[model samples]
Target: MALQVILFMTHRGRTQQLVLRLLQARRLFPEDRTGSRTRHQRIAERLGLGYQVSVMVPALLWVLTPALVDAMSAPAANGTAATRGTPLPVWAPFDLQRSPNYELVYAVQAVTNVVMNLTGLFLDVFFVTLMLHLTAELDVLNLNVASLRPSPVAPADSLESRDGDSLAKQASTDAPYTARGDSFRVRTSTSRFHMYRLLVKNIQHHQMIIM
Candidate 1:
C-alpha cells in the first residue's frame, strides 16, 4: 500500500526511488548475462527483492485497473443475464451503482488497491517459499570465467527491520496498545486487509496519505 501511494503520487511511472537504485545497480552489475551462474545474486542483492517489488506491484495494479473500472461501470443489476443486461457477478459486490461520480473513482482506486496489495503479498510469500524449496536442487556455477565478481551477500548481522524502535515496541509483547492517535496494528494474512484498513482510514478521517 505504501507502493500504491507512491504510484498514485508518481502516476504509473518508474518510482523515483526505484529509478535511482536501478541505475546504481546497473553500474555495479555491468556484466549482464555473463552466461553463467553466480552464488552472489549481485543484482538481487544490489536492489533487495523487496525493492524490486516496486516495479511488479504497480504493473500488476495497472493491468487490473481497467478491468476493475469496466466492472464498476457496468449495469447496476446483479444477475446472469436472465434479466435485461444485468451486471456481472464480479462487479455486483461493489457499492458503485448507487450514485456514480468522482466519489466512484476514488472507491474504484481504493478497491483496486485492496485487491492489488493483497494479491502481491500472497504471490511474494509464495515465490519466497518456492525459492527456499529450490535449495535442494541447487547447483554451483561462476558468472564470470575471466572477470572478477565481488560477493554481494553482506554480513548477516547487519540485516534488520527498519520498522523502528517504536514499531517494534508496538509489535512487542508488552501490551496491546495504540500509538500516535488511534493507529493500532491488526493481523492480516493478506496485504488487502492492510490496504482496506488504510482506505477506510483515509475515507473516515477525510485525509490523504501525502507521505
Candidate 2:
C-alpha cells in the first residue's frame, strides 16, 4: 500500500511537471499572426482548466487514509467486557488488547502515521512552490514572446524573400504535425496519471479490508 501510494504520488508529480512544460512552451510560442492556435496553447489551456480536478483525488486520499486506518483498527463495539471475557480466535495472530507486544505495535503504527502525514505535507508544499515558480516563468516567457516580431523589411521576389516565404509556409503546414505529437504526449501522460490513481485506490481498499 505504501509503495503504491508513493508510485501514485510520483506519477502525479510527473503529470504536474509536464503541464508546467506545456504552459511554458505555449507562452514561449504564443499563437501565429494568422490567428491560428498552436498545439502547445491548446494542450496547456485544456490541462490548466482540468488538472485541479484530478488533484482532488490524491489530496482526499492523503487526508483520509490514516483516519480510515485508525477507524478500521478501532476496538469492537462490544468493548472491554468482551475483550476481557472472551478468548481470541484460534486463527488470530495476536489479540490487540491482550498481547504483551501491543504497546510496541501501537507505537509503530503511530510512527508510521506520523511519517505518512509528514510526507503528505511535504508533497503539498512542493506542489505549491512549483506552481508559483511556473507562474513566474510563464509570465516572463509571455513577455519575451510578445516582444519578438518579424523583421520590418518589405517583401520582394529576390532569393532571400523566396527562402523566407518557403520557411513560413513550412512552419504553417507543420502545425498539424505538432498538434498530433502534442495530443499523443498529453494522452499518454493523462493515462498514466489515471492508471496510477486507480491502482492507489485499489490498494487503499485492500488495506482497509486487511486492517
Candidate 3:
C-alpha cells in the first residue's frame, strides 16, 4: 500500500520538464505543427499490447468494475456475514462495516481503488509523452545554444596544422616546392643553412623575396 501510494502520484517530474523545455524552445521555434485543418478518416490498424494501452486506462476500469466489486464483496475465511444495519469486518482497507450495507461499502471501495489505478495510469502515460517531446526540445535547445557559441581555436588550429606539415616535409628531406593559391611558397636549396627561400605574395606591392 505504501509503495502504491508513492507510485500513484499524478503529478510527475517529466511533465514539468516537458513543459519547461517546450517553453524554452518556443522562444526560438515559435511555430507549432498541429494536425491538418481538413477532416480526415481514421486509419484502422491492428494494435497489440503496449500499443496506446494508456488511452484505454479509464475504459478498462469501467469494464472491470463488476469483477472488482465481486472480488471485494467476498467473505473472509471466517465466513461470517454481517447482521442487518451493522458494519462487517470486511477484508477491505477501509470500514465496510455496515449491518446490511457491508457489501455496498465493499463494492464502493473496490471501484474507488480501480478508478485511482486508472488515474495513475493516465498520469504515467501523459508524463511519458511529455518526456519524449522534452527530449526533442532539448536537442533543439542545444542547437540554438551552439549557434551562438564562438569558434575557439580556428586560426590557431590552421597555423598548427601548417606547422606540422612543414616539419613533416623537412623530416622527409623532400621539399618538392609547389605553388599554392596566393600564399607563400618555399624555394629549396641544400646549400643554404635554412635550405629554403620564401617567395611571398601574388600582388606586386605586397611581394617579398625572403632569404
**lDDT score for candidate 1 against the true structure:** 0.41
Query: Where does candidate 1 stray beyond 4 Å?
Result: 1-122, 129-211
lDDT by residue for model 2 (1-211), tens: 4674687577996656556664554454443343233333454555544554455456556545644664567577877433322111223366655555544454455566556655655555445544554454445344444544433332222212212332233322222222323443112122343555555544543332223
TM-scores of all candidate predictions against the true structure: 0.21, 0.30, 0.33
Q: Model 2, which residues run further than 4 Å from truth?
A: 1-103, 145-159, 162-211
Candidate number with greatest TM-score: 3
Ten contiguous residues minimizing lDDT sum, candidate 1:
136-145
- lDDT score for residue 31 of model 1: 39
The Cα error of candidate 1 at residue 173, in Å, is: 62
* Per-residue C-alpha lDDT of model 1 across residues 126-167, encoded as one tens digit per residue: 445434322211211112222333334333233233332233
- Residue range 1-58, candidate 3, lDDT tens digits: 4465566455456445546645554454532232111111111111212434754554
Q: Model 3: number of clashes?
A: 8
* C-alpha lDDT of residue 61 in model 2: 62
Q: What is the lDDT of residue 197 in candidate 2?
A: 52
